[model samples]
Target: MNIYLVYWNSLNKFCFRGILDESIGEGTHFLIPWVQKPYIFDIKTRPHTFSSISGTKDLQMVNLTLRVLSRPDTAKLPVIVQNLGLEYDEKVLPSIGNEVLKSVVAQFNADQLLTERPQVSALVKETLVRRARDFNILLDDVAITHLSLCWKFVTGGNCQRCLEDAVTRIGSSCRKKEDGRALNSGCYLRHSPHKFYNNSSSNDVAAGNRGHRKMAIILAASSAVLALLLVTATMGFFIRKNVMRKRRERKQFGTLLDTVNKSKLNVPYEILEKATNYFNDDNKLGQGGSGSVYKGVMPDGNTVAVKRLSFNSTQWVDHFFNEVNLISGVHHKNDERRKNTYTSESLRQRFNRDSGMHS
Candidate 1:
C-alpha cells in the first residue's frame, strides 16, 4: 500500500505508469505499487525583489528596484510544471520585469520619472501583472521601491578595449530580446560611452582610433552650443503659446465677472481646493466619461460640484475649451436677464408709490 500525507498549503500531482499525459495524482492505495511518481508544490505567496538598470528618455541611466508579491495559481500548476518545471518564477519574472522596465523607463525623461513616480509605478505594475498572468502567475502587489541614476561610471574614452570590458563585466545582466539575439543590451542601461563599437560598423576611421584628447573637447563644446540653441528655441515657443492661451481664457473670464458681480458662486479656486480636501479620493462623487466630479462644501455652507478633467486623456482639447465657453456664456446670459427683470420691477413700484403720494 503506497500512501503519503498531503499538507493543506501544498499541492501534489502524481504520474502513473511512466506517463504523465492526462493522468495525475499518484501515490495512493488505489494506484498500483511502484508505478506512481509524485510532485509537490507549495502554494504560498512570496516576495520577489529585483533591481533593473534602464535608460531614460533623456538618455540617462536609471537604477530601479521593484518588489513584487506573487504566487502561482494552483489550478495551472500542472501546465506550469510541464512547461517551466519547478523553477518557473526564476525563468520568467526577472526577464519580463526587465523588459517592462526598459520599455516604460524609455518613455519618460529622468525628471518626469522622479516627479511622477506614482504614475510610473502604476504603469509598470499594470504591464507587469498582465505579463505575469500569461505564465499562470497571480501578482498581489507590485511597487517601485527605490530609484536612482546609474552613476557607477562616468564618461570613458572611445576604444575597443573599453567596449570589450563593458561587455565582459556586466554582460550577464543583459537579457535576450524576443528575436533571439544575445547582443550587448546591458551597455544601453549603463554609462554612456563616447562611441559605440559593433561588429557591423567600426568607430570613426578619420579620428584615427586615438583617445578622446582633442576629439572629446571639440565634440563637447559643439554639443553644448547645440543644446543651448535648442533649449532657447523650445523655451521661446512654449512661452509664446502659454501667453496666447492665457489671453483667451482671461477674455472669457472677464465677460463672466462683469455679469456675475457679487454672485455667491464667485469663489476663488484655492477655496474650492480647501473645500474638497485638495481633491481627496474620499470626496470623489462619481466619474463620468469625460472626467471625475467631487463633492465640495464651501465655507458659507454651500455644496458645490468640483469637476476635474484628465489632461493626459485622448480627449480633444477643443471639447474642453468648448464646454468652458458654453458654461461662461450661459452664466453671463442668465445674469444679464435677471438684472433687466429687477430694473423693470423697481420702476413699476416707484410709479405706483408716486401716484398714491400725489392723491
Candidate 2:
C-alpha cells in the first residue's frame, strides 16, 4: 500500500490505472502501490502588482501601476490543469494584465486618466475581469494605483511656482474632499488620504483660468469668421446661379428668333406698297371672298401674286389658315428658258437676303 496527502482547500484528484479520474479530499489516504497518482492544486486568493508602459489616446507615453486581486477558479481546476498545466499563472497573468492595461489606457488621454482615476480604474477592472475569465482565472479586483507620463515634462519657472500655489490652495479649500489634483501644462499635483505624487509644489491655478478664457475668446472669434464666410459663399452662389439662368434664357430666345426668321418671308409694308404701285386699280388682279389679290413687281424686277387678307372680315382666321397652307405647298415652274417664276421658298430666301442688306 502507498500513502498520499490531499488537501480539501483546493481541488485534489487521483488518477487510477492511468485511465480513471476520481476526486479526493483532505487528509491521509491509502492506495494500492503503482495503482494511482494523487494530483493536488493550490487555489488561493492573492494580489499581484505590476507596472506597465503604454501610450494613451493622445499619443502620450504613460507609466501605470496596477494591482490585481485574483484566484484560481476551483471548479475549473481540472480543465486548467488539462489545458494549460499547473504553471498557468506564471504563463498567463503577466500577459493578460499587460494587454488589459494597455487597452484601457488607450481609451483615455493622459490628462483624463490623471484627473479621473476612479472612472478609468472602474473600466479597467471590468475589462480585466472579463478577460481573466477566458483563462479560467477568477478576478477579484483591479486597481490603477498610479498613472504618470513616462517622460518628465519640463516646466517653466513661473508655471512651477503657480503649481505650488494651486496645490496649497486645494489642500486648504476642500480638506473634506477625498481626492484632488492640481494640473498644469508640464506637471500635476494629486493629493489623497494617502500620498500618491511627488512632494513637489505646483503652479498657480489662476494661470489655468487665464488660459481657458483666452481659448474661449479665440473660439468665439473663429466661429464668427466661419459663419460670415459661409453666408458670403451662399450669397455668391445664388447670385451667380441667377445670372447664369438669365443668360441661358436670353440665349435660347435669340436662337429661337433666328430660326423663325430664317423660315419666314417678311416683306416690308413700304416695299409691298411700292411694288403694287401704291395699290393702284390697274395693278389689281382679282377679288376673293376673304380679300383681294394684286400683281406686284419686286425690287429685283420679278412679278408676284400677293394676296392681301381683310382683317376686318369675319372669315379672316379661316382665310389666313388657307393662305398659310397654300403658300407652304405652292410651286411655280417655268418651262421656257426665259421664264423665271419663283417658289415661296425662294421668296423667303430673297427676303432674308434683302433684310440683311438693309439692316
Top TM-score prediction, candidate number: 2
Candidate 2 global CA lDDT score: 0.69
The global Cα lDDT (0 to 1) of model 1 is: 0.66
Best by lDDT: 2
Residue-wise C-alpha lDDT for candidate 1, range 32-139, written one tens digit per residue: 455555565666888999999999987889999999999988767767777898899989999999999999999998878979999999999999999999999999
Worst 10 residues of 1 by lDDT: 336-345
Q: Which pairs, if any, clash in model 1?
A: 14-25, 14-26
Candidate 2: misplaced stretches above 4 Å?
A: 9-23, 151-184, 187-359
Model 2, range 1-359, lDDT digits (tens) per residue?
87767665334334433423334456888766554555676666888888899998878899989898888887677677777877888777788889988999999987788888888889888988998899889988788887778544444876778787777877787578898766555556777888665533343566677789999999999999999999999999999998997576446435534544564545665677678887668998998765677888989887776666554433333445565566556555831122122234443454344422110
- TM-scores of all predicted structures: 0.39, 0.41
The alpha-carbon RMSD values of the candidates against the true structure, listed in the order shown, are: 36.0, 17.1
Specify the poorest-scoring 10-residue window by lDDT in model 2: 334-343
